[model samples]
Target: MSLTKITDKAGLHRHLEAAMQLEHATIPPYLNALYSIKPGTNTEAFHILRAVAVEEMLHLTLAGNILNAVGGTPDMTVPGFVPLYPAYLPDGETDFQVDCQAFSRAAIETFLKIERPAQGATPGVDTIHKGRKRAHHNGHKRHGTALRARHVPGNEEEHFYSIGEFYQAIEEGLERLHAEMGDALFSGDPARQIGPEYYYSAGGGLMAVTDLASAKAAIRLISEQGEGVTDNIFDYEGEIAHYYRFEQLLLGRYYQKGDARGRPTGREVAVDWDAVFPIKANARIADFPEGSALRQGAEEFNRAYGDFLSLLTRAFQGEPALFVEAVGGMFQLKELYYQIMRQPLGDGTHAAPTYEIPHG
Candidate 1:
């Protein structure tokens, strides 16, 4: 099999748009698990989920900046921008499906798979390995990597072995296109850039991409934060990369400074496995009775989520400060998540945010 490559300016835009979707894709699952945890229990898991979700938002913003830097429009309102639950990621992993579910061992396991690094594959390195096939999970046949840009027109299919390699391809494309097109490559309006002042999250601050160097920095931060390059556990800043942070939950310990890779020798990480509200996996609003309050709550959450994305769309378009309003909307959705999760599904499970962006 030949390695996937980005060969032109339009092709690079498609990949960056896919990167935005890829970053935003992880948020719902993380939020579902984070909100489903009973208020006080699983504090460690709670912190990890919350932090990772916030970082994903940052990643999405950074991708938007890079897209805008390269004269490409970033549109979150595009059809199929929000993925259905239990869907495969744009990162080309066929081993597991990400679902909107509660915080549990199973959810964390999926999170690990989402953030899993491709060993021996660094950014700018070819990731195609010959003759290696993964057994399909849940009896689903491997149909190769799914193209996230099916909703977008005039773009060819692209796939990567991991998120890091995906961003690396974008970075390399930026380099190639910059050399070929010169200043014309970064022809985007500077007004669309979202600086650090407009965003603040626990994971880290945002970077504004203006040139190839800044664009590469933004992509590097997104990839390294998701999965540290090579075999390293910590990112460049000495902070634990997201993969290791999630792994800490599975290993039942925190990673401390000077700890060797794969062996977190810090204090025990406490987890109350039973403290979570067992919401239905891959839940849809249809799961609730049409006239039921649970159904209304799920729909309301989806509507609010849609509105939040709209706010984000405007923020990315020109009004970067709209992020403040979007942050407020997130808190509102948090309350709605709690209201829904508190209601019983009558099957020993509870309701979760369906994340279905209601269309006109």
Candidate 2:
């Protein structure tokens, strides 16, 4: 469907504009660092960051669809739209910083600021809270999270606290959606939300949602990122096309689809295990000589990562508001992590640290 044209018409034009704009905001820094790297050395970090960056485009498109279905002009060009990242969103604790010089760990910090929930824990007054219906399902999902982070360094086992509570909290929002939309809730034209023509990213995560429930669920699937699927804050429907390019570089094969869904799957998922990552994960720690900037970076990183995880424990219940604190704490630690990761560790490789949810 031409974005300029539409079939069904019932949505907020401004809302869609805002969503897509939000999505587009992330493109630059990711672009600068990904393309600036030396070809084969930083593969892991490159692939991961590039994959994530492309997916952000897809998110922007999806946001556009929601807007277009309701009669909105998808505006990519906005004043200061590409404003440098690490630039604060409406309510970030610290100004998000996205300097092009050092991306390794710093990129993720800017990202966390963008991705981590905003502060203002007070709902309705400071934050808005919708009432609920299907609290149970969300509660069930909130049961636990595989990824737990801390501001204070910790082990994987320690970060496994149940995400069930967060899911439960989100249920209130879902129930609110149903209450507001009623039957139109799950019904939309597949051509309207999901489309195969613009497949982007690794898994071709976009499913061309055609109904309200599918719309929410389709977008929701994106809430989680896996090998094949990922969601970018941009909300573009097809920006992901840029993601698998590095994969294309590594696997020496491009992603294509055999399914009616027009998504990349199965053998299409091939990769060259031998090919080195395009960017540095900085997984090594011995190349640099002792007492260098690199050595200092390593120590700083361990402590910062530790802090990011500790904050995750307080809001494991899905309190988006609490995520505000986690988000803020994450940034502080993120800046520290970035500085440390960028310094060339004596050896140029650092140990990869894993997280375990704390028992709180």
lDDT of 2 by residue, 189-226 (tens): 33344344435334445554444564465445434331
Which candidate achieves the best lDDT against the true structure?
A: 1
- TM-scores for candidates 1 onward, in order: 0.90, 0.41
- Badly placed stretches (over 4 Å) of model 2 are 1-15, 84-86, 90-97, 117-178, 181-194, 200-203, 226-360
The whole-model C-alpha lDDT of candidate 1 against the native structure comes to 0.79
Query: Candidate 2, TM-score vs. the true structure?
Result: 0.41
Off by over 4 Å in 1: 1-4, 121-157
Q: Model 1, 34-137: lDDT tens per residue?
A: 98889988888888888889899889989999999988889887657888878777655545678788888888888877887764633443454322223232
TM-score of 1: 0.90
